[model samples]
Structure formats: C-alpha cells, structure tokens
Target: MTGRPGGAGTDIGLISLDEAGARAAARVAPVPGVLELPLVEADGRVLAEAVVARVDLPPFANSAVDGYAVRFADLRPGAETRLPVLGRTAAGDPVGTLGRGAWRIFTGAPVPDGADTVVMQEDVTLSGDEVILPSQSRLGANLRRAGEDVARGQEVLPAGRRLRPRDLGLLAALGLERVRVRHRPRVALFSTGDELTEPGRPLKPAAIYDANRAMLRALLARAGADVVDLGILRDEPTDLERHLREAAGACDLIVTSGGVSVGDADHVKAALSACGSLDLWRVAIKPGKPIAIGEAAGTPFIGLPGNPVAVFVGFVFVAWPLLARLAGATAEAPVVFPAKAGFHHRKKAGRREFLRVTLERRDDGAVIARKHPGEGAASLASLAQSDGLVVLAEELEQLEEGSTVPFLPYAGLLG
Candidate 1:
C-alpha cells in the first residue's frame, strides 16, 4: 500500500511526468469542427489550415525615414554635393521620376522612381530649393524594398498554430478579413465531496467553500475551452453515475476534482466504471500523484487531485497537453531557466517536486530561487505570494544552497 493521503495502492508502476503527459495527450482526439471567425475575434483560437500570403507585406517600395530621396549618381565623390529639391511627397502621395534632383519624402512615403538612396533629414543640410548630401552615402541605403518582409503566395502561417494579437495584425496586413479556426473544446467541469459548499454560502461544521470548480473554470477558459460547470456533486454513487453519463453525452471532455482516491467516500472510479472505464495513474510527482485518466461514455475524462496546488500542477503539466491536442493546437512547452538555490533542503527520493519560490538577484550577479516558507500543498497564500516554481527532478535527493536549479516562471507557463 502506498502511504499517500488516501491510503491507495500503486499497483501500476509510477509514471514519469513526461510519460504521463504523453499518455494523456494520446488518449483524446481533436474536436471535429471548424468555424470561420473575423480577425478581430480570432485571437487565442487555433488555425484550421495553413494561410498563404495574398499580397506582399508593405506592398511597395517606401522610405524608411523622413528624408530626401536622391539618385546615387547625383552625389560627388569625396565632397559634399548639392541637388535641387524638386517636390515634396508624403505617404500615399503620387510619385514622379527623379530628374537630376531630390524629393523631400516623409516616413513611409513611396521612393521616387530612378532614386536609389534616402538621406535622413537630420543628416543633410537644407538650403533654399536644394539639399546638401554627405559625400559618403551608400546606394540603396534607408530604402525599404517591396516583398522584403513577406513575398506573395508564401505560406505565412501553418496549421495548428494558436493565433496571437500580433498574428491578427499579420493576417490583417495580408488583407484577410476572416480565417478558419478550430472550435474551442467543450469541457464539462465539476467538484465532488459532500463537504464542498459554494462560496458566500453559510459554512457548516467541517465544510469548506468549493474553490476547485471556480479555479478550474478560469483555467480552462484561459486555455481556450468552453466550460460547462456542473456544480458540486455529492458522494452518492448513483447520482455520480447519472452526472457522468450526461456530461459525457454533451461535452467533448469531462474534468472533475476529488473522489478518485481509494477511500470509501471516493466514488469517481466506481462511477466511471459503471459508465465507461477508468485508470488510476500514480505519477511520480510531488503534491499530485493519484490522477484519474479515462473515458466516460466514449468522451475523455481527467480527474485531478483535490488539493488546490495539486490541481494547479496537474492541469498545467498533464491535462493541458490533452486539451491542446483536442483544440488542434501545436503543443507549447513551458520555458525553464537556471537559478541558484538560496536554501538547502532534502526531498523524498523517486518523485519530482515543484516548490513555490521567489527569485532575487544577488550581489554576485546571480539569480537565486528562495523557497517559500510554507510547503503545504493546500497553501494558497504561498502560491499567490511566490513568483513561480523551482522544479526538482525525480533523481534529485537533496538541493544544496548555491546549486543551480531550473526555474519555471508563471508568465512562461500561463502565457
């Protein structure tokens, strides 16, 4: 028997976090639907197909600065040359060929034909009807060429890419009004245990407000999933079975918190068995171990541990990859950077651990990861007060002060 909180047995060998993530990703299929959305509403959605450039970026040759456009041959070598200023051209104005003269051009204005160089206004002296250019100006300097940024008919974006704000700007520059994107995965979410009470309700003896459902809803929303909140479910076996059946029928995936352990009150496994199938995975990870991965009525299901911090870790590390694949998006890995440990501590062997830590730049020009004072998995304040997590691999038995460790910032994980 394993010495976990619920006294469950680890008959299945402990799965590595990476292997568990891959298994979870392989269990579900992408949601089978697509929709065309305007560019304004397509941010955070996944592209359904590859997009090709319809027109060249910039679409024409223009000036890179507010300056004078002149031909390279007009400048004299080793001496300053004066050229007559013919006319002024602003952005979107018509251009005329240069005839042994220079044209005053503003930023983004088209360069005149037969002109091959632009001299910045600050670099040249402006005399009446003439501009004095320096003796050393390279041909084609400060002039933007057409089709330099992106050529027409080139594939600008690939399939399964998540659209960002800047991606919308790119598509807009290509003159695309709408794009086809994968529909958001519909997720049915709920919390278990008779002791869970909704927030703002009267708290009875031995009951806490249901924080997991609300937190999970927001997390799923941020991951681009349409959530179907099924509220808190009691421990009754028959009621749990009914709810799972309904959720499986209506949603692409089912997510639940708690009730997956071996205790008598924990009934998620039995409920899933009645409706479909369940596999209890004891992953070799700290704070979260007993994860339920299965399918209910042919729809995928993921049961996370009840602890708040455990839920956060399981969702970020395990469930997110599955969600990403189901949404038809390219998998994004969290960036990990190195930092020195500020404190020394021994950890349990054979399990990966993530400690909430705040970073400080030392006088020696090294960043140090300081572990939070509280190490409990239920400590929400520790999560809020800390910057991110410092990961310790399963092989690491102890961490020494001043040792380099990998740090994962919240910005990198959440974004």
Candidate 2:
C-alpha cells in the first residue's frame, strides 16, 4: 500500500511514522478558545497559563502537634526548670503574648508570641498550672516555620500542564476559586466497511462488529479530545465523500478506520481525492502499514487500519500525537524501559514491529517479557492478555532469550 493519492498540485509519497507525524503536527494548529472553569470542575483540563501562588501555603506558623511553646533556654540538660502555664491555645484560637517563664500552645494552633520551641505534652509533667520540662529536651525541635511549605509569589504550576485531581487540590489550598484552561480539541470519527456491524444487532456471515470506532473514541477522549461520532459509512464513493466533507467542516480533525486499502471496494481514497487532498497513505510500520493521512476542507484527516489492534496502534502512534498537537500540547516521545526477553523472537529487517508481550517479575526482581500467543492485528484479546509492547527496531531481525530489549508500558499512555 502507498499513501493517499497526491493532489494535482503536489507530489506525495510513502513516509515513515516520524516524518508523517511531523508533517501532520506542522499542518494543524491548536484549538481556539479558552474558558474559565471552577477548580472543582477543572480536572483533566490543560492550563492555558501558569498558576502562581496567591498566598503562602499553610499561611502561618502553627503547631505540628499538641504541645507547649517555650523558650529553649528554659530546658537545659540536667537542669530543672518550671514555667507557668500562660493560659491555652487551640486550633483557630488566639493566645495572648507569652510572658517570661511561661509557655502556651496546642496542635495546629499558632505559636504564642516570643515562643521559639515546642515540647510534646508526653515529654513533660504538668502539676496545678506549672509545667516541668524534661532535662534532655532539644531546643526548637518541633516548630513549623512560616512559608516553609510554599512561598508567596511562587509559580506553583506552569502553563500547558494537564490538571489532575491532586493538582486541583493544590489550587484549592492556594485559595484559587477558578482557573484558565485550553479548549479541548474537537475530533470527528467515522468507520467504513460493508462487512461491519454494530454489536447489538445480529451478524450475517461476512459481517463483523465495528469495534474500532468505539475504541478510538475512548482513546481520543482519554487524550483530551471532545469526540463527535460520525458513525459508520457504506463502501460508496459518494457517501464517503459526503461524510468526509461534513466531518472536515464540523471538527478540527477527522479520524476513520478501514476503506483505504488497495481493493476495489475501498472508496475512502477516491472520496478523499474528490473532496480535497490526501497527502500520505502508507507508513513503514507493522500491523498499521495501510495508514492514510491528509487534509479535507483544511481539516486534518487520519485514516487507520481495519483490524482492531492495528486501529489502536495507529491511533497511539499517529492520531494521538496529532490530537495532542491540536490541543496545544508539547508532544514528547514515550519513555521506554529495558527488560530481558523470556523467549526468542524474529521479524523482518526493514519494518518496525511492536510485539505484544506479558512482563513477569523474575526472582531477581527483573522484568522478563514473553510474547503473546497470537500476533495478528485483529486479535484484541492478545492486547488484553499483554502488559505492553516490546519494540523491535527496523534493523533488528532477531532477539535471543535473556537479551535486553526496550519496551513501552501500556500503563504509561492509557493509565
């Protein structure tokens, strides 16, 4: 297979996944519009600007435990000292100035004036308003200094960062009621295959349920895109062309699975050619070789494979980055970790392969990866049974048992 047919104005050819990704990212712009949302509803939203500290965290120096605040000089080793109880202070309560030879404090309560240290109540004996400090107590052992947790005017969060539940709590601690976040990218999804059927309906002999549409929608939502389902289309050039035009006009990006193959019934290519331009069609990757990329009505269009696993891989390897770039995200390659191979594996030399494998913890605390039983791109169960993908570089054809190989954990991206 090759990339989509080039337009009359420009020449297009098959490119690697990296080059295609760069071109797609360069062609697409970030989603427009920003909205101020309450911190309570801001989870999973990317920040449009940096979050600075409105006030110091903790706000004031308070007691870390229920104890008495006193002058360190009053408690010396082997020296007996008795200080008068200068009243009491509880959380959110104020205690007047600490007179000489007296102490006052409590848990979470502000330290009284002129007191520099706190001694736990368990370490001292109290008898009728008089407190006796142990001779071995250290000076200033339990004081929580003001501005220790967060300083005033500090930049707590930077722009372009996605907010999590914990991040919202941090903003709450800083007393921010609202935040500014980037607009979510609008993604339009559709599928093409006369043999495809929805799950609820009974299937005919040559029909299969359209799983790629649902799967890609979930993945795109996880990547922070506002997905609009364009449903499935028949294998007709006119119908496919109409949907492609509508999707392009309605959404920032258009994604579809199937109908980009070389077979005669595959009308997606012709439809794209009729509408606008299809720039790329194929990539140098296994399982997802028949990928299609182009622009229709100035909206980016990504065509994935028909196989379930291939659709997902293509989404992760292609569509996900495109969506992230459109959402104003600073895209970075996923991190890979080294693991030992539990079994030998073989592949071709020119095409990159992502083998599904289950990683087991060995006795030595190292991870050993074993390939799944079935390697077909249509086997969705194989992905469910595996932990991650063991990437084989284009030049490598064989890997021996116990050889160290780089792998990417599915947990990193999906979780």
Candidate 3:
C-alpha cells in the first residue's frame, strides 16, 4: 500500500469516489473567460447564457399530411361526405381560404383560414376538383399546432448546456448565427517515468511505449479543452520541476500521467508543491485508486495513473467531470441501465468496482451483462472488447448470476 504524507496539503488515506469528486469539484473552478463564436465554431462548447427562441418552431400552423382541410363538424362519423376542392396548397405556399367546401393540401402547406382538420389524401376519394372524405371519428387529429415543438421567447437552451449537434441546429432555427460560450480551458499535458517512450520511437531496454499521453490528449479534446502536450519527461526531479513550472504560467490546468503513484522516481508530487499545493487523493475505486488533484502557480493540475486502462477509467470517473466543470459545462453522468448479471463474482467491499462488460440478450429477450474475461489495468483490449462498464456500487460485496446491476455503455461515458 502507498503511504500518505502530512504537511504537504494532501488528503490522508483512501477516500470514497464521492469524497474525491466533491473535493476536486470544490477546488477547481470554471475558467474565467467567455468568447463570442459562430454557431459552427460553438459545437461542443458550453453556452454561457440561456438561448431564447426568436421564432416559434415550424413558424406557422401547416398541414401535417397531404389531405383535404375541412371543418370537423362538417363530416359525419362513419359516413361518406363530398365537397368540391377549392384549390391545392403545397409546402411554403398559401391557398385561398376554405369555405364550407374542402381544399386540397400537402404536407407543410400553411392551413388556410376556416379550416380546422385534415384528412389524408389516401383516406379520401378524389375525382377531378371534388374530394370525397370518408367518415372519420377523429377530429382535428392531423393539425400540428404552432409552437408545439418550441415556443417563441422560450428558453430553448439553458446556461451551462454543452452544445451538441442538435443544439447547433436549434440555435440556427432561432436565427442566431453566433453564440456566447465559455472559452475552452487550456490544459497542459505531460507524461512521466524513464521507462516511458514515445509510441513511434524504438523502445530501449526496459522502456515501454507511452500510451497515456495520446489517450489523454483525445479525452481532453473530446471534453472541449485545448491541450498543449509537453510530451514525456524523464524521472529526474529537475526536469519535471522545470516543465511543470513553465506550464503553470501559461496553462489553466496541468495534467500529468504516470508519476502520481508513490515511487522513488516520481517527482510530480514534489513539483506540484514547489509551484502550488498538491493533494494526492486515493479514491476508493478499482482500476484507478491513486489520483492527485492540485494546482501549480494558480493552474489546476490533475495527476492520473500511468496504466492505460486505469487512465481511461480515472478520466471517466473523475478528471472528465472536473474538466467539464472547468469548461463551464454541466456534468452529465453516464446513463446507466439495470441489467441481469450473466456471471457471478465477489470482490472486496468499500471500493467501487467497474468491470468492462459486453451486453447480451437471452432467449427470453432480457438484457444480460457478460463480464470481460481479462481484468488488467494496463489491458486496453478489455475496454475494446467490452461495450460498457458494470458499476458495482461501494457497499456491494457479492454479485450473483441473474441479479440486477447497473450497466453503463461506452457511448455514455466516453467522449
């Protein structure tokens, strides 16, 4: 077990996942700036202000289907009725008002005055200008009301909303060509350990390729933060201290992978203290336990584990949310669905365990979670083979086959 230190501003002992999260959240704040950007450029950005709809969605009440527009009272239920068609109305065009007679209308065509209901063209018999509407019990069923989707002057998107593709389209519909969004927090990234080498380069002796940096870069980018990769640093204290100090001045946050754990070669904790206070939080989570939260010269720093899969899980559980908060976005936890366990396993209590799992449907058509065969913090294949994670809660100690458990798909957690 790694030992905790006092007098360095680091927390003592192993803390629960909730406790670690709360501490991290309390320490890190939203970056202090906003930017006005075009709609296209605002994709994946957090909205700094609520966006109100300038016009109602659809803009006007129109035909929901190609049919005849008439008064609901005019047609008797279960009886045939016939009336002369005044004219035809297509999408984006207006036809003359409907009298006591019927008027032909197409989908998206503005409903003329005096008409309240529409019957599909398929349901009606057409002969020249006369449209025969069969008896229909449903009245005013086909009319899509104006502002049904979104009303004018309504807050279409609240502040702190992370802009998605649909959000962009909605903003465009509101006639907003640009939006005020929070500036993406600039993150400085570095990797530690002499055993680590760049992926493309040849490894020397006991050195292994650095996978943490690349994974972190993608994760940070997907979270909508700008990343400045400082590459891999040797285990030397002087090298680590120099790079971290320089990064502190220019970056809003500093992220280091590998040297977070207690090792003689690890200088990240020392480096953070030299620049700013460092907190090594041993979170109660499987795969990733040692996560460090600190600051270097007013820049927030998050130290992640070196193991590839641990780095992935750590980011998903802690760093990801922290980064989102810094970007002024509301944290969206992964959507979890209850599923039956396909296998049985028991683990030590107290720690929240996340097992990579693939979902399957039984002959009865119920969803079952099949745990991945391999369990290793450094094994990326397990994450690749599995569709999502089976989250064993903090208090759970044993899992039996067919028992319901919460499963989170990769789509929800991964950026």
Candidate 4:
C-alpha cells in the first residue's frame, strides 16, 4: 500500500474532497467498445457518436391551431373581412394552395402554399359557409415554420451524452431507428466483513445483514453500469486477494465496501498491495473519510467505508464520476440550490460535512432545509427520509439558523 488510511487522530496523507474525486476520475478511462442499438433500447446508454438531424423538424409549415388559413393581405386593417371557406384540411392531409377564400385548417395540418397566417377558430364567428376574420390578426401567427425546432444536418445530440426519454423522442422524430452507443462499463462489486450475513437468513450473534451490496447494486444500475456481483467476502486476506485477482481480469472496474481502514479486520489494502498496487487515501470529509482507490491485478478498484450512509455518500461524490467517465458520459456535477437553514449545526474545521435534510417551503415563499435528527454515520433512515444533503464547507465552523446554505437534492444525483 502506498500510505495507510486511518479513522481518527491519524491525519497523515488526507486529501481534499476535490482531490479525491480527481484521483478517482484519473484512474480509469472510457470503455472503447461501442454497440448499435435500436432507438427503443438506447435509453440510459451513452452516445458514441453525435446524432445529426436527417430532416428538418416538421419538414413542412403546419398550422398551430384549428382555424382558417389565409393570406395576411386579405384581412382588412380596421374592419372584419368575411371570406367563404374554399376547402378543408386536417393533420396528415396533403397541402393545397390557398385561393381567394380561406382554407379551414386543423392543428398540425400543413399550411397551404400561398397562406402566411392562421386565425384561431374561437376568435372568428362562422356565418353560413363563410368565416368572419378579426381586424387585428397578426401576420405569420398560429403557424409553425419548417425547421423551426431543428434544421437538417444539425447535431441534435452530442457524443458523450446519456440518452433520456426525451432524447429518444428527438431521435425518433428525426427518422432514426438505430443509434450508436458506448458499451456499458462492467463493474465488479462486493462487500467485506466477517460480521456480515446476507438478508433473508437468520443472523447470528454479533452479525448484521449485508446492506451495502444490495444498495450499491441498485445504485450501479441507475448509473448505467453492468454490475458483476461478487457477493459478500469474508475478512480473510487470502480469499480477498484471490477474488480481486479473478475479478480484475473480467471487469472494467472493481468496487468493494469495507476493509480499507487501519484495523485488524481491514485487509483490503494489504491484499491489493500483494496482487497489484494500492493507494489508500484519507479524504477530509465527514461520514466517509478513508477511501481506498487502487488497482487489482491491473483493473481499477475502489474500497468504500462499511457504514451505509458513508457508502452512499462516498459512492455519489467519489465513485459516481469515475463510473460516468468510464461509461463515456460527460461530466455533470449535481446541482445545488441555496436554501435557508431551519436548524443550527457546529462542526470542526478542515473537513467537509454533508447533513441529510428535508426541504420545507415556508409561508413566506422561502425554502428551508431541516436537518435529520439522526446524525450517525450508519443511519440509513436519514438517507431514506430526507430530500438530500445540506453541504457544510470546511471553512464553516457553525451554521446558524436562518442562514443560507447550499442544498443538493437527491433528484439531481440519481438517474
């Protein structure tokens, strides 16, 4: 191991939160393989190539409302002009040329060749076969021009962007059936601890059910990684080293929770050192402090804390960006909004802290972040019940009530 990572009192080689993120991102590169999938299967996949528009959006000018299509010159400036309905057109009907009278056009119908304006049907009264036109209808109103939304040959979606539902709709609108997307990064995941047992089984004395694997599995799926579950590992250095060696050859990245701290039971750092190399970083952040980032037999590895909340925070701040980069996704930080603090908190200097908080909109139209009462590192309920995290910077010694704080919502972090 490069350097030892400890829990408390030992602060030798502790890096900042930003530095930890940068080191993790620098350890892995994007997967080179690409695959072509139909538009229906492309959701949540990163684009390997930019999507160019094959044709102009709404290739033809269409009516924006159910109304009359007429030449702007036909309407009198200060008086109502009556025109006989010459023809009718609905959506998908071939467009026709506008004559002396107005053409009754429905919404989304192609505008007639000689018409420059459309008046809403509700704005004019119909008498016999003629429609009364209002005097003040503006020119080019209620019409969608060709290529208004997107032009042909334009890049609608850039490479490295994760495809969403709306992005799929845009691709379908451009008449594309298949899209080239980067191959999903395969991640080998596991948890280590002698006092852990799987759920659905009776727990022995001094043992707890394994929660990290299940939670991390779901989070990995949400982040677009194809997870290779190695299951729960016992705290044996030989077995751990063997598993890491096998996983390294098959997976693009290997992730484990627990067994990185400087304790008798922690053997991940030593096992990694035996097989390949290890960089044990003590990050200056609350909940998650000692994080192990290294390689196992040449494959990248990340060892997170065993505490559920710490694992969650560590994955979001440290591992998530590395996974995104490996999956060919562009870097996107979670958006944080300013909110008033409904409670007060005090912390030490030289460490960043994240408080689980729920937001409340006060009667005065101000958003307030109320911190969760459970402040333990392993409190899973705090993560479940709260909206997101209220970030307290290292320089902030005390957060007073009613002070402005930066709040990051969980909605912005997940898929």
Candidate 5:
C-alpha cells in the first residue's frame, strides 16, 4: 500500500505539488531523433537541430526611414543645404553612388554608395527636383546596416526549442525550405468511471457524461501529442487490466482520469499495481489530491483525479510537461508573476491552493487578481469564468486585499 494516511492505504507518501512535478519530469526520457519539415509546416514543432543562418538578415545596407540618402559632409552648420533629388529609390531598388546630392529613398531602400546617412522626410522640405537637408543631421542617422537584425552564421534557432510562428517566418526569410524537428509523442488517453457516460448519447438516469475524456484528449493534443483516445471504461478489474495493458503497448505515455483515489472502486490503482509497478501519490494540492504514477507493460502512466478541475490541474501541472519532455522539448515552468489581491482569501494551512481569478490592470501598472466568488474545486465554471489562477502556498492561511501574490495566467498554460 502507498498513499497519504487519510486516503487509500499505500506505502507511498503525500508529496508537495513541486515534488510531484519534479518527480514526473525525472521519470520521462525524451524521444530520440528528428524529422525534416517544410518551413511553412514547422510551426509548433520542436527543433531538434540548431538552425544556423546562411546570410545576414536584410542582406544589404538599407534606409530605415522614408526620406533622402546623402553625404553627411555636404551639409554646413546652422544653414539648410539644398541638393538635387537625382532619382527615386524604393525598396529592392539599388541606385548608383550619390555625389554631393540626394536621392529620394523609401523605407528599406538600399543606401547608395558614398551616402553616410538618411534624413526623415519630416525633417526636410521637398522642393521641385530638390530637397532641403538639415545641417544638424548626424552621420549614420536613420541608416539600417546590413545584418542588423541577424548576423550570418549565427544560431537562429537553437536545438530543443519549440518553433513558433515567428520562428517559422524567420527560417523562411533565411531561405531554409526545411527544418529538422522532433517527432510528436503518441499518447494513450482515457477516463475511468462507472457513473460516467459519453456526451451526445442519451443520458442514463444517474450517469453524467465523461467530460474528462474530451478535456484530457484536447489538452494532450494541444501539447503536441498524437492522441489515441481509449474512451470511457468501467471499474471492472478485467476491463481495466485489458485496457491498461493495451495502452501501455501502443503509447509512449498513458493517462487516465479517475479510479486512482481511496474509494473501493479504484480499479485503476489495483490494475496498475497488478500489471506492473505503481506508486499512488497523495499530492498536497487542492481539487486534485489523489494522483498515481508508475509503469505498466513498460510504458509510463499518470493517473489524475475525476473532478473536472482536478483533471485540469493534474494535466497542466504534470502531464503536459511530461509530454513536452518526451517530445524532445525543454519543459519550461509556467511564469507566475506578482499580482495584488482584490479581495481577502483564506484556506487551510496544510495544502497548496489555486483559485480562479480575473486580472485587472491597475492605473499604476500593477496587476490585480479578482478571485471568483465560488471556490469549489468541482466548480468547472470557476475555471471557465476566470482568466488565471492565484496560487497560495501551503502555509498561507489568509491573503489580505491589495497584498502581492503570484498569479499564473491561463494563456501560458493553455498553450
């Protein structure tokens, strides 16, 4: 037996949320190798190879402003110097050298030879076939040097980085048609509960739709896993055994929502223990206290709680990072920033808590977290209505209004 004293009798002990996360991270081995993808298709893929740039960004000395390109030495002090506008130079148009004169140049246009600076159109008055240059315009003013944005041979995208849309665009600009990225991990996902039914089916008199299945599947897929949904299962010993074995064989990671708690109907705990190794952890966190981690049929399994919010907590805090690691990515923790509390809050001292909160940007630029009135762990609506969560440490019994606390925004977690 392994668990906390109040829960299912188990040899495993109650661990803090931090310990649970670190433990989950320690258990995963990143999948090896890579696959080449076209630049447009590489968005959201983890880079397996460092991308070195072949050429300097911009690739030429260009104008940073839509004005005139000229020689800095031609202007005299305290007086405006007039020069002929020999020709117009637009972006991608290269002009001949400027000899004691000016050329009308649009933004990004290459600066002609002998031209040391650019002057904004607003700084000088344009006369017919000529422009007035200010004597005060300094050398190199408004000039965009070649390779200013990126230098050739620089590491543009480092290895183990998850590529974003901007990365894709940068790689495209660098003329890399293909990029090598790690293959997504295949995950087996399911939910276990005798009282649950699938949505869109006629509801049984006493059963609820298995929301965890859909939710977990979505979370896994969004985290870059190839999801193999195993659907809902009963607490029956034989059924759990069969599915657990099958999932272990087919998936790189296995996840189940329900049947890992202290209840007598916890067939997931029993099945995992009998099939292989199991450590049912009692994590010291609210909404989700009972969680399990182990191996079955040589595959890793993470068992989360049945409550909708608990499932969310476990997936966000553990399973997502586990998947990222297995997919050859460095799983960075979600950023928690200091935010002022708009209302007073209190909780028991033994466990950590995450409360749903809406953030308001104060006039002074301080972020304020307004907690949801309903604090129920099972209140899924609270999670839906709030923008982020205000994290309370285990020893924090109460937080007063206007006090600083850490807030984890949903935008960072959902991605």
Candidate 6:
C-alpha cells in the first residue's frame, strides 16, 4: 500500500487494524443530546438515560388462568372441599371482597384478598354455584405475583442501550409514553472514481456500476445512522474538496470509497489533507490495506477501499464501531464462533485475515465451513453467497484442515 504525504499532526506510518481503530475512535467525540421522543419513535435509538420502573409490573397479584381463587389450607391432597361461589370476577371487574366459601376469577383478573391459590376450572366439578376443589391443589398455583417481571425503582434499560422492537414493547408495557435517547449520527456518504457508473445506466467497456456506495449506505442505515447520499465525485481534487466541505458542515461523519489508493485519480486523500488533518492512513490488512482516517473541517472522514467486499469488511471492522461511539451507543465485541477449517490456508504473519466461507451442517451435527472459490475483493457475488468470515490471527502461518478458527457471521452483524 502507498503512504500519505507527511503533514502536520498526520500519522502516515503503517499500523495494525487495532491501532488504526483505536486512533480513529480517540479522535472523535460522541454527539450530545437527550431528546425526549415517544416510544414509537424510539426504536433503533440509543438510550441516553437509564429507564427506571415507575410502578411494579402487574401492580397487583392476578390469576394466570380462568379459574377459581381459593385458600390452600381449605383443601388437602386426597380430601375434597366444597366452597360456594361468591361473585364472578372477570378481567377488569371488581371482586369487592372474598367470602370464606369461594370466589370466581378469570385470566388476568386480580386475585381476591385472602386468596392464596388458584385452581383451574377443569380440575374441579361445578354444581349449582358450588365447586369441589381437588385435593392436589398447590399454594400459589396459576397466580402471577406483582413485580414478577419488574419492580418499581429498578433500572429496566440502561444508558447506551440500542432499543429494539421488543424493547419498545417492554417500555410500552411499563406505561412509558416517552423516553430519552441519544441523537442519531448524521452520516454523509459518497463515491469517487472516473471508471465508475451509476446503476440503471448504460455501462461503457471501461466503466462499471458503483456498488460500494449502495452497500455502505445500507450498512450505515442498519447501524442506526441517518445517511445522506452525496452521490459520486469525479477524480478531480477540487470537486472532491467541494463535497467534503458540504458534508463536513451537514453531517457528523463523512464516509467515502474508491479514492484513497495510490493511483493518480485517487484524490480523496489529498483533498482531505488540504481541507483538514489526515490523522492516519494505510492499515496492515488484506483486501482493505488502503484505509484512510482524517478530519475535514472538524468532521471525521473515513475513506474506505474501492472494492465492494473490501468496503464491507472495512465497515464491519472499522466504521461500525466508530459510528456507534459517535451515536453514543454501547460498544460490543464482534460475535465469533469456533469452526474447524475445511481446507488448508496460508497467510503472512502480522496481518489479520478475514476469509469468506459457507457453513453447512455435517452428518454429525457439527458446523463445517467450506471456503469460497474466489478471494478477490471485487467479487460481491462471492460475499453474498457466503454465510460468514473466518478471522485468522496475525501470528499463524499455516492453517491445516480441521484446525479450529474463529468465524464471524454476517447475519449477526446486520441484525
């Protein structure tokens, strides 16, 4: 990979992926705000404050079945006790007070005072407003206690938590009409290349349709970012500089692909340096070695590789976590699973490798990974057809078949 021209405060040295990520994360600050939004609009937003329970869930003890509430001491394992049915208590109906004889209750109805157990209607025989309790009745049977799901004053959702659909449902169940959440990070994305053409247009012999922009936009949206498509820029430094300036003023972060390489048409690196400080460039990784991290007019700019697969890998390893941090989201380590290598692979030391593979269930019910045929960074079909990527550490030289390796699933990342 080529290096960036030396400038004030620019680290042009080659660094490992971990070092590159750490440096990039340290350069940006989290966006500040605690906006109060309705629960309906809070889905996919990170919580700025911890949500504490205001009232006990199921505030009162209720019956979990449509049955009669009774005292456990009134019946034994073998003996039958007859109790007169007082008033029927359906859901939302008031059961004034329970008489010593009995009380009728339906599902979700509050258990009557002085009742300690519930017996399903099918377990007893009813005759003329009188029911015989089975001797096998147990105490607290079919009864849901107050605060079983949540307690008043308990923290239900912590800060930095990304709210999911089920999380919003839980908040609604708690009667929370509104919640405080971190502001979404505005991301402006663009592409740059003379040989690139937009989809749905006729492609010349030397030009190919742009795929990195769409792919990265989808990935950013999936990460809960407010994406602004800035379209494509030519191989001119002045044109790239204009877009960089606009993006810097309008967005919290700027991401672009296809202009950070060593070719003469690759003017994004120079444009960024001319606009602001280019902090780091060129990470030591396969398929994505030509990465760039810079700040243009105080806005963080990430220049990803031109290849489609490389752009995706770079986003997963670098941009995703940085965007989460900028959006005030809690960071989580990538999910990895142990898989046995189905083929022998060789790699150089001191550089992480992400090998694409398809996972299949073997006859013994074990997951066996099969490596894809093409390993080129521009092969989007291979990445789409594969299930996950196997991560090889920087130290190992050779990996034989049956060797245990860590694999990361693409489905998990998107989710």
Name the best candidate (by lDDT). 4
Candidate scoring better on lDDT of 2 and 3: 3
> TM-scores for all candidates?
0.95, 0.88, 0.94, 0.96, 0.93, 0.91
Tens-place lDDT per residue, model 5, 268-376, is: 8889987878754689887788889888888888999999888888889878878888988877778888889999876666577788899899899988899897787
Quick one: how many clashes does candidate 4 have?
0
lDDT for position 271 in model 3? 77
Cα lDDT tens digits for candidate 4, 1-415: 0112342343456688898889888989999899999999999999999989989998999999999999999998988999999999999999999988899999999999999999999999999999999988999999999999999999999999999999999999989999999999999999999999999999999999999999999999989999999999999999999999999999999999999888999999999999988765588899899789889999999999999999999999999999999999997888989999999887766678899999999899999999999899999999999999988876667678999899999989886
- Candidate 4 accuracy as lDDT: 0.91
lDDT tens readout by residue for model 6, 178-270:
999988999999999989899999999999999999899899998989999988889999889888998999999999998899987789999
Q: Residue-wise lDDT of candidate 3 within 199-259, one digit each (tens)? A: 8898899989898898889999999899999998988877788898899899888888988
Alpha-carbon RMSD, candidate 6: 5.1
Q: What is the lDDT of candidate 5?
A: 0.84
Residue 337, model 2: lDDT of 94
Q: Which candidate leads in TM-score?
A: 4
Predictions: Cα RMSD each: 3.7, 5.5, 4.4, 3.9, 4.1, 5.1
Candidate 6 achieves a global lDDT of: 0.87
* CA lDDT of each prediction against the hidden true structure: 0.89, 0.83, 0.84, 0.91, 0.84, 0.87
lDDT of 4 at 341: 95
Give stretches of model 6 more than 4 Å off.
1-13, 77-82, 125-128
TM-score, cand. 4: 0.96
Full candidate order by TM-score, most accurate first: 4, 1, 3, 5, 6, 2
How well does candidate 5 score on lDDT at residue 174?
Answer: 84
Model 2 Cα lDDT, one tens digit per residue, 1-415: 1112232322134477788778777779889889999998888888889998978877877778887888776666687678889778888986456776556577888888778788888888888889988787776678887777878898988887778898999999989999999999998998999999987999999899998888888898888989999788999999899888998888999999999879999889899889988888887677788888898778888888888888878888888788877887666578899999888877665566788999999888999999999899999998888999988766566678888888998877663
